[model samples]
Target: MKSVTILLYDGFSNMVLSCLLEPLRAVRDQSQSALHWHIVTPHDGPARSSSGLNIAPDLACKDVIKSDLLMVVSGYGYRQHAKPENLRPLRLLTRQAASIVAADTGSWLLASAGLLDDQTATIHWGVISDFTEEFPKVRPSYERFVKHPRISTCGGASTALELMLAMISEQFGPADAFIASTMFLHDAAQQQSTGRGPNRLEGKGTAQLRQIVNRMVETIETPLSLEELAQQSGLTRRTLDRLFQAELAMSPGRYYQLMRLTHARELSTSTDYDLREIALRCGYADASALGKAFRKAFGHPIRKSRGSRPH
Candidate 1:
């Protein structure tokens, strides 16, 4: 039996740990194998999770000698809860594991322990930039899950399940993975084998528009006109205009311009770029033109009060 230990801290997110463990339980039940797992806390007392749920651990961190896999889970208020003293044992345990996994901001713990150097990893998308700025040597990946043989890291929540399912598929078979998926009902309902899954929007012709919108966001530093966007997307200008009006309740040109202005404001306040350069990069002829548009749209100058970072 392979042993798995989940390192739990005061602010750990229970959902991530559950997502990681539940599938393994399902797999174990189907195979009737002794897949051992133990929840380890810094101490013997119950640890509080982000959702205000308190969990009692099976063991203390100091008692964990060796494990095949160690999953570290973290959440909001993690910085306040995570102490080097409490994590020191897990840091040592990481070296002995067949693989180390971090869910959500758990990467912070790994990075702090100096375990992620030169390895590709990822965290929740919301904290990507901050994590990058803090850990320069670690190559940050945008995938929901990134595994380099020994170290497996994921963004958050469902991505943890995705990582497990992918790993299970490799160890077992795609059919068994699909069975696991059916039990979880996550990607399961992609087939009828899993009962009625959650209702998902079929996108109703909005999928293509969403793809185009994503491209516009990426090209914010080099804004494109509606006609140019339509040409690039291989859609007629009229079709693009109608799609925007129906889905976004705005003209294509208006939506595109707003996206550019939004990115310009983000760059101005968060980055050290100059106003004129920001304007030119956003496709404005001059800084004044960009400022006027910015004020008209947001009722404030680009360099005025700092804007809340996008979530």
Candidate 2:
């Protein structure tokens, strides 16, 4: 039997936890190998998710027994939850467990406990810059998930599943992992092949449209005009507009503006960059110009949008 212990904290993401657990459960159901899991919290009692759903812990932090693997699951308000005392138990677990994994912002907690020092890891992409700035010793990666010796980290829900599937492959075999993936309707090959591009528009439009979208993403700091985009796509301005309308139901200019606004929103929320810096990165003249565009596109102030997210 392979024993796994999951450490849960207040305001942890239930979705992320489910993604990591379901595949393993499937493996246990389908294979002869026994997979056992227990959920634990820092203190004895229940832990509530950000959505207010409470999960009763199987054990308290102090009573947690050694396991084959220990994974910390966390999400919003991680900075506030990652207190010194909360991290002490994790530091102890690092020495006890054969393998350690951090899911989502759980990397922040592990990094705080100094377990990720000199190890490559990743967090959710939305906070990659903030994580990198905060944890200089831990090498932050752009990959969806990173596996190191005795330690691993994953970005978000889907990536968590990917990490678990890969672990299943390592533990049992590729056939067992494939069976588990099939149970979840997950296409492992497609998931492995997909890159972290701007968006998923590869099969939605013509080759020319894909080229134009790729160009827009690559040149967010210096966006091209419609004429330039069309020229690069080997189409005239009118033809580009028609193609976009036919494929995406939006004009080329609107699509371009939406793309820039999306990137700006990501920067505003993920990075510590000021408004002027974000504007320049999104190819606006100044903060004022970016604010107007953002409001027109998203129907809310950038500051308000950023503020809505948990710190």
Model 2 regions lying over 4 Å from their true place: 186-311
- Model 1 lDDT per residue over 245-272, tens place: 7854468777677667756765775776
Off by over 4 Å in 1: 81-83, 186-198, 201-311
Model 1 TM-score is: 0.60
Tens-place lDDT digits, model 2, residues 60-153? 7777668799989988888876778667767766677889889989999998888788889999998889999999998999998998768899
Worst 10 residues of 1 by lDDT: 185-194
TM-score of each: 0.60, 0.59
Error of 2 at 190 (Å): 16
lDDT value, candidate 2, whole model: 0.77
- TM-score of the candidate numbered 2? 0.59
